[model samples]
Target: MRAASEILAVWHAFDDFPMETLTKAWHYRSGNEPKQRSVELMRLHRERYGSSGNCFDLALWLIDAFRREGISAYAVGHDLLTPNAHVAVAALDGRGRAYLCDLGDQWIEPILIDAGSGDFTEEPLAGFVSGARVALSVRDSWLHVVYLRPNGKRSEQTYDLRPIAPDALLAAGEYSQRLLRKPLVERRIYTETEVLHWELGDDASYLSGKRGRTEEEPMRSLADRVERIHRHTGMDRQVIEQALTVYGTASIQFD
Candidate 1:
């Protein structure tokens, strides 16, 4: 069992707070790599406070920390086809046999959760003095969770969890170091949201235009924009740009 301090440390490392620091870290640039907004947030945190790990860094550290705490954790790669990002440790027994003890897995840690998948499950990760029912969903084969906050506002979180041998991680790590060259495909980031998968990259597709929107107002807004563009548009290019300016670049093309 991890001590209170260690658990708190893990929480502190992962909590998405102090937007300024997080902004820099999220946007930090390395060499010729493109700017990542999250890196900016992280860099700000590192500069002002000292050390703060991004989701990937946090997972790696968590695996190491769990190992220190006597858990035989191993890292695993996610899906081969999808974005399939993130990593976590596998549970190993005394005889070195590994089962699906993905408790420490970062992408789908909730699966390791002790409670049943029902109405009254206690979720310590809910971050509330009192836990709430965190709903789960899938998109592009990725899993996600939705829940209400203390203020009654709702939000969602995404992640992946994988099961593999310790040797698999060592091999994957070595392969990346030796062979793979693409940064986006190479460096694993712990963005495990099912929604994000449908919204990222060239193949991104929306189940509907309303995949991300939860209410009618936004949906109507989308409808209104599309109607206006259809009724009186100089060209699709201009309409698309107008949509981009209002709803974002993805909104224009995601159908």
Candidate 2:
């Protein structure tokens, strides 16, 4: 029973979001214009969770929060044998337009896919999850990350694929079947200056450098990052519309 206020409180504590983005998000909720910047959302989420929030827990908290708010969403189970506990959110309006939103990357923008094809109108900043192939596409807004398994001659499939750690996924191929039983997904997000190492199950941990150093000033706060992302890409009205189109579907409608 996660409350929306509890979630917001977390965002407030960590100071994850910049003041402007935080202000804008609230505006979107209140029928005002929302800004374009994933870092703002990320920072806001961090502030909400304080220090206790990790990637998986934050995801779980979001699921519970969405359910409480009467929103529709699901966590893609990993496999038939064992499923990943990670979750992604989806909502649809009466017009048949659906939105699938995930806070798993630097691009805070909700990706717009055709629901039937695994194609993207705007490609994500990150690469595809590999080693294990999972398909999560739907006619509605809910897209799944699917994995296939051989059933007799043919194959049976499952839709819950969590983000795999790049190294573990690659290593799993070389290891014995017994040793490869554990799931591995790369839970990382790379910005211009920082590479956040998310826990295997948690997606929203504090960002750190990958190798030598990470850029500090640009990412010091969520506001700075949001402004930077906007400046770098020159977020236009079209991008804003796309994001609104996705979030606007969150409203409830009756038949």
Candidate 3:
């Protein structure tokens, strides 16, 4: 089994990586089409102009980073046919034990996946101070991850354990950008920070931040949304303006 100390180290290194806004215009503008190459995405992340992407972007970067550190890792996903599909990284420690490291999902620590049994629940690194509990159970060939907060609230995500190939993952990325009815794709500008979620839509702009604070404002014009994103995310002003000009002009409905 991978030592708890080692897993904790990797978890802390990537825990705070920002999950930025992704728009269809920005997706195609990266190149002729959505490019799923981790190297290119990582390069963009290093460049201030390239910090924004969806879950696949985040998972791909994590896979590359883990491999560079000599950890055996691969990209995994579930619900490929649905709009709610999600991606994450699976890492194998020195002792051949597998763990789930999902920065995009904002998991505080790596979760241990027990393969032999259909049910399991445990703290990531027992004796390490953390307020989250991870529980795994298998049903109908789907692995469910239940993340429980110290206050008794819980969030659950499920995925297939089968490893996803790079080409397949790339294709999935394209489908999600084009065909998936996701809020990320529908919103003119969507962003999630550590404690906030901002989405600009046709009718109204929604803002939700820490401590259950949520408010709505009249929809701002495309230009205004771009400026708001620029001011809020610290992304390049020119890049945001260009993307909004090219992609944000479409008429989209809000929920």
Give the winner by lDDT: 3
* Per-residue lDDT of candidate 2, residues 112-138 (tens digit): 334543344332222222112223454
Q: Could you give me the TM-score of model 2 versus the true structure?
A: 0.31
**Model 3 residue 29 lDDT score:** 55
Instruction: Output the number of the TM-score-best candidate.
Output: 3
lDDT, candidate 1, residue 153? 59
Sort the predicted structures by TM-score, highest score first. 3, 1, 2
Task: Give per-residue CA lDDT, model 1, range 1-255, as digits (tens).
Answer: 112333344333433221111211222222223322233443554556433332233334446655666756555436422223335344443434332222222222222221132322333233221123355554443445565544455766554444445455444432322221111100112243331111111111122111332222222344454333222222233333342343343222211
**lDDT of all predictions:** 0.33, 0.32, 0.57
**What TM-score do all the candidates reach, one by one?**
0.33, 0.31, 0.67
Candidate 1 colliding pairs, count: 32
Winner on lDDT (1 vs 2): 1
Error of 3 at 255 (Å): 15
Residues 4-99, candidate 3, lDDT per residue (tens digit)? 566667656654354543433455556655445455655665475734566777777777777777788887878664566688878877766667
